[model samples]
Target: MKPIPLQRRPRGKKPLWREYAEALAVALVLALVIRTFVVQAFKIPSESMLETLLVGDHLLASKFAYGIKLPFTDTYLYKGDEPARGDIIIFRYPNDPSVDYIKRIIGVPGDVIEVRDKQLYRNGQPVRESYIRHTDPTGREPLRDNYAPVTVPPGKYFVMGDNRDNSLDSRFWGFVDKSAIKAKAWRIYWSWGGLDDIRWSRIGKKLL
Candidate 1:
């Protein structure tokens, strides 16, 4: 008797749409991961950082510069370097956590900060700030020009904008808690002034 022929099963394949969907899902997850733990992008909404950062400037911020925090929480997974003086950072607004703000760290914990006649002083000595600009250098506003010395409390930081005269910063609000800080400004990736204007010089510029 002739031997019976064996039956063969065909290999299964995923639908084209399913393969595309899977690829897209992976891409989105990677983007979210990078945004949460590596870096993020921001745009300059105002002239608060003038000359230093202009309106419409798009920049990248290093989220891991401070620490790797758990998603949607203040708890850190891996603690990183602390914010130092002169470091520009993005943080949640103290008065309104729903809002985000950007400013430079002027004083760290236990630091005494003051301003006299438009001059910034830290620890009773004049702090050199070549990047700061004074739109109203002669303005006599007490808070803007002659602020009384105050110590930055522990786990808090005193921050200010590069545009000394026009910015509403720590002098107007209060200290930024360490937990509220989000990321450090890294570099400018793109800049647009208007429909027909692009700030070519600002592109690729590093944030000091």
Candidate 2:
């Protein structure tokens, strides 16, 4: 015999607050997953990478670009990729992991990076930074007040801001350990304020 269908209990009226809370919880979890191993959003806070990355510009950083690290932990969750030269990246400040900073990776593991009069030399050759909008044609100038030649330790990187004149980066703090890297900035998805007004042809374009 065919089983009789169970009688349905009278449907209870659900409070809208419960639905809202459930939705919010799901959103938070999704955000955490994305930030942990997919893509993350970051805002440029300074002009250090100007002409390349500007303040108030919103960019998407990919977790898979380098690899995934355990969220809120130092453990390595995965090592799926490696960073390439000229990549704009976001990382926890070496001095303070609580604070995140963005810059371009200039020197990779084992690279001997030095600055000679604002010119970047990697392994005894001048790095070609044609991406720069302008530099003095007469001669190279010191990008920062301080000067030092840093030998990138194995498994570490030397990062600098594109706006050499304005950023407080490796020159000030020190090299960024590979573990400190968070993501590779790949695209400019959004912008805000006055920066939005100066719409260059490259705005909203992929990071080169």
Q: Tell me the alpha-carbon RMSD of every candidate.
A: 1.9, 3.4
> What tens-digit string does per-residue lDDT give for candidate 2 at 1-208?
9999999899998799999999999999998888778998888777788788777788888888876667667666777678878888899999889999988889998888887777778888988996653333445445453256778998888888877766778877888988788888889887765843755554678987
Candidate 1: Cα lDDT at 149: 96
Span of 10 residues, lowest total lDDT, candidate 2:
133-142
Best by lDDT: 1
Per-residue lDDT tens digits for candidate 1, residues 103-191, read: 99999999999999999999999999999998896679978888999999999999999999989999988899999999999999999
Model 1 Cα displacement at 92 (Å)? 0.2
Off by over 4 Å in 1: 1-8
TM-scores for all candidates: the values are 0.94, 0.81
Candidate 1's displacement at residue 9, Å, is 2.2
- Model 2, 2: alpha-carbon shift in Å? 12
